[model samples]
Target: MDKEKLAYFKEKLLKMRSELIDKLQKKYAEAIDIGKGDGLDSADEAYKIYNRNLMLGRVETDALKLRLVEDALKRIENGTYGICISCEEEIEEKRLEYVPFARYCTECKTELEKKGLIRM
Candidate 1:
């Protein structure tokens, strides 16, 4: 890809990373507050548990996204941003458009899925 295209994808990934971080931070703070609340009612307990679980899931997803964005940025640095991680092949532009952080081409991604290793 040309430098302009690479920079475009980098911009998209950075925007996504920033949004994910903001959401994760906000949810994490809310979860902490819920944990500190003193109510012991059943509804309160359920809400706390739900919030905790949701926050945990969000944290994990956010961590993965952070890694993906970092990897993508590293790719930009190394001049390999739109290549498949498994096959070292060029990823489809359409796929990249849909998923700016994609690190695998369709074939490799399908193979990973067949191996029960789907990323998402």
Candidate 2:
């Protein structure tokens, strides 16, 4: 990848991480506020369920994003940011534009799916 493009992706990834963290923090604050009130039984139960689900969702999404950010940083360090992991080939520019964190080329990704390494 070109230096400018790599820099752009780096900035984007950092921003995404920051935004995710901010969202999670806000969610935690909301959860705290919800927990502090001894509201109606049904409302309390619903709040608990909602908070659990929200925490789980945020955890999963943030974990994936963190992995992507780490992988991108590794690629930047190893000088292979735009290269596919499975094929050891250059990844499609268009695909990278759509998913800057992709570690495998389309073919390898398809193969991994066939092998049950991935479901999609």
Candidate 3:
């Protein structure tokens, strides 16, 4: 990709990374502030456990996305941002536009999914 396009994608990835970090921080704060409702009824205890689990899952997902964004930024620095890590081919522009942190082209990604090497 050209320098201009690379810069654009870098900006997008950085923005996404910032958002994910902010979300993770907020979730972490909430998790720390969560109290153990020792005196709560059974239904309330169940609800609290469910919400905590849901928040934790979201935090994990956001952390994964943040890592991907950081990896994409590193690839940009190495001049391999738009290339598929699995196939060593240039990823489609449309795919890059949609997922600026994609590590593989569609074909390679599909193959990995089929082989249970990666998940969506």
Task: Give Cα distance to truth, residue 116, candidate 3, Å.
Answer: 1.4
Ranking by lDDT: 3, 1, 2
Across residues 1-120, which tens digit of lDDT does each residue of candidate 1 receive?
A: 998999899899889889888887887787687677575898888888888888778888887888888888889899889999888989999999998889899889888989999865
Candidate that would win on lDDT: 3
Residue 27 lDDT (model 2): 68
Indicate the TM-score of model 1: 0.89
Pick by TM-score: 1 or 3, better one:
3
Error of 3 at 105 (Å): 0.2
Per-residue error at 116 for model 2, in Å? 2.9
RMSD, one per candidate, in order: 1.6, 2.7, 1.4
lDDT of 3 by residue, 1-120 (tens): 898999899999999998999999999778655545778888888888888888888889889988899999999998889999988999999999999999999999999999999974
Task: Write down the lDDT of every candidate, Cα atoms only.
Answer: 0.86, 0.77, 0.89
lDDT of 1: 0.86
Against the hidden reference, what TM-scores do the models get? 0.89, 0.76, 0.92
Q: In model 2, what is the error at residue 6, expressed in angstroms?
A: 1.7
Query: Residue 85's C-alpha lDDT in candidate 3?
Result: 90
